[model samples]
Target: MIGIIDYGMGNLFSVSKALERIGVPYIISDSPEELNKTKGVILPGVGAFKDAMARLQEKELDQFIHQYVDSGRPLLGICLGMQLLFEESEENGRFQGLGLLKGRIVRIPDRDQNGERLKVPHMGWNKLHFHQEAPVLHDIQDGYVYFVHSYYADGIDEQALLASAEYGVQVPAVVGQGNVSGMQFHPEKSSATGMQLLTNFAKAMERSEELL
Candidate 1:
């Protein structure tokens, strides 16, 4: 079964629904034992980084998550959950993050060298463009997906970025490295395009297990 870590402050319903629709066996739980038994884990959230971290810590799932990451099992983080995979975020007074990935979160640049107004919270339907080809993106077409965030990860290693979207500036839409993956957009709400993304992730998890 796939494990959805329900620490607190997650878009739990939509994410759970997406997994169900994809016919993936899954459970949402804060229990470390249940989480450890799962074939793969997903961290989904639609809230502040600080608050989510607090809930994970309170539930004592933080260390478990770290151990799982080191196990080389796939662990996907969605939206704000993706931000928490990093070292720190500047969302509210330089709050620290999970440091699962080597990076820091910061606000997107509003102006390019050309000096144009780039809006924050880059919401609405935007195209997902792959940074470089990877198996996780297999059969995944470049299409529109929903986004609802003001800040995006910056100065991250280019190798970790999987896809980007235009929002006055190129925004990181999908990110992955080794066994960890993330999405800045809400794949659960993006309809066929979104469902396809989740399905793709499910397939990726399945493939990882076969190799083991």
Candidate 2:
């Protein structure tokens, strides 16, 4: 079973529905004890970085998450949740992140390579370019994924980057290191490719369990 951490943020309904469609059992919980009973955990969020971090800290979920990851259990962060996996973010002033991965989050530049003004939030479908092999990316070749975010991760360790999208910049889309992983795009909203990715993650969790 998967545990969806709920600290009063995230598109929980959509994420839970996706898991249901995939036939993966999951529970939404704010209690760390309940989350500890799950095989894998997913952190999903859709809100401001500072506020989200504040809530996580308020609930003491931050410590639980760090400890969970340290135990070598699989943890996936989606969208804003993904950004929280980084070391820090510059959105609405400098704020520390979960620090699961070595990187910083910054707002997507408003200018293109030629200094042309571009849209702030890079919304819509974008093609993914794979950087390395990962279980979450199994059977997922090149394809477009839905993205709706104004800020993007930067200065990330290239080794942890699994996929990226170009929107006048190399936006970190899929990133993973060991049992911890993150997706900037909402896989639950990315159609077939998204479903496949989620399915892959579920399978990966099963494989991990089998090994144990």
Candidate 3:
């Protein structure tokens, strides 16, 4: 079973429904103890970075997350949840993050290199461009996924970059390193491509269990 970390700021409804459609067992909870029992954990969020970190610290879920990843289990962050995996974000001002992955989150450029005006938030579907291999991306091909955020990750090491999308700038879309991975898109709402990614994650979790 998968544990969807509910730190009072997750898109719990959509995420849970998506998992259900794929037949992946999941439980939602704010208690780290309850979540710790699951085979894998998913950190999903839909709010401000500063506020999200504050909540995680309040519940000590931040420490729980670090411990969980250190145990060799899998952890996947989605959307704002994905950004929280980084070291810091410049959303409302510089603020520390979970630091599970290297890099920082910043606002998408208002203009491309050509200085042409570009849209902020970047809401809608964008095609994914794969960079490296990952279990979560197993058998996954380049396809469109739903994205709805203004900030994107930057300065990420090449090894951790799994995929990206062009949106006035090269936005880090899918990122992973070892037992941890993240997606900037809403896979649950992203049609067949999204479902495939989640299914792949489930398969990866099963493999991790086997190793234990």
| lDDT by candidate, in order shown | 0.85, 0.94, 0.94
What lDDT tens digits, residue by residue, belong to model 3 across residues 94-187? 9999999999999998999999999888999999998877888877775899999999999998999999999988999999999899999999
Q: List candidate 2 segments past 4 Å from native.
A: none
lDDT of 1 by residue, 1-212 (tens): 78999987897999999989989989999999989998789999887777888898999888998999888789989999888888889877788788877788888777765888777778789888878887667777658899998878876779999899877666778888898888998989999888888888888888888977
TM-score of each: 0.94, 0.98, 0.98
Indicate which candidate wins on lDDT: 2
CA shift of 9, model 2, Å:
0.9
Residues forming the 10-long window of minimal summed lDDT in candidate 3: 133-142
What TM-score should be assigned to candidate 3? 0.98
Error of 1 at 1 (Å): 1.7
- Candidate 1 stretches greater than 4 Å from native: 110-114
Off by over 4 Å in 3: none
- Order the candidates by lDDT, highest first — what do you get? 2, 3, 1
Scored by Cα lDDT, where does model 3 land?
0.94
Candidate no. 2 TM-score:
0.98
- Between the candidate structures 1 and 3, which one is better when assessed by TM-score? 3
